[model samples]
Target: MNVKSINILMIDDDAINLKLTEVMLKKHANVNEIIKASNGLDALGVLDKRGDIDLILLDIVMPVMNGLEFLSNVYSKNSNFNIPIVVLTTDETVKKEAMSRGANGFIAKPIAEQALIQEISKLIDLG
Candidate 1:
């Protein structure tokens, strides 16, 4: 797939996670723009912005609001809610709950670059 056609929205409170993810993805993924959110609440604010985000990489635990709370708000919103969400977390229990709450899948962090790439590739039609 062409690396300029796909866009990803990544949300994490940790600066390192965000930076690592972008760097890992930049080489192969067609990244239009990466919107960074410090917490789940901040992530929600980006939905209104016009951009080419296809999938969301969401973190489970954060300071302002957690991933679950963010998912709940997302599903409840009237906006286009069909965007695929992959939960990235350090907690196994939280991953299970996130899947139950309508997450497409869960990826544990500190994310392995190869596995994360494969997972995201499967979720999005990257052509």
Candidate 2:
């Protein structure tokens, strides 16, 4: 899969998680660009500046606004935009709800290198 032109948006509250995920994405996906946001509210700000984001790796728990709220807001704000969002979380209980809300996929916490790339590839049809 040639994802050289794909830009990814990564939303998480933890700085460590953000940096680690960025490293993994750089190593595995070779993505065009990875935009990092500390929370969903900040993520919305990022979206305002960049409209070409192809995918979003989002965390469910965050300050200001959570993943589900972000999803709902983004959808409501711009109903025409259809970027794929992959939820990153530790809890298994929210899987159904997350999907129902608008997540294209899910990645468990303590993210795996292979799984991350695989999910992104599948969602964007990288292969």
Question: Which has the greatest TM-score?
Answer: 2
Q: Would you list the C-alpha lDDT of every candidate in the order shown? A: 0.82, 0.89
For candidate 1, write residues 11-38 as lDDT tens digits.
Answer: 8988999999899887774666777888
If scored against the real structure, what TM-score would every candidate get? 0.90, 0.92
> Distance (Å) between predicted and true CA of 79, model 2?
1.6
Weakest 10 consecutive residues, lDDT, candidate 1?
A: 1-10
lDDT, model 1: 0.82
Q: Name the TM-score of candidate 2.
A: 0.92
lDDT of 2 by residue, 1-127 (tens): 4445789999999998899889988875458898999889999999999878999999998999999899888888988869999999998788888898888999999999889988988888664
Cα error, candidate 1, residue 86 (Å)? 0.7
Winning model by lDDT:
2
Candidate 2 yields a Cα-based lDDT of 0.89
* Clashing residue pair totals per candidate (backbone < 3 A): 1, 0
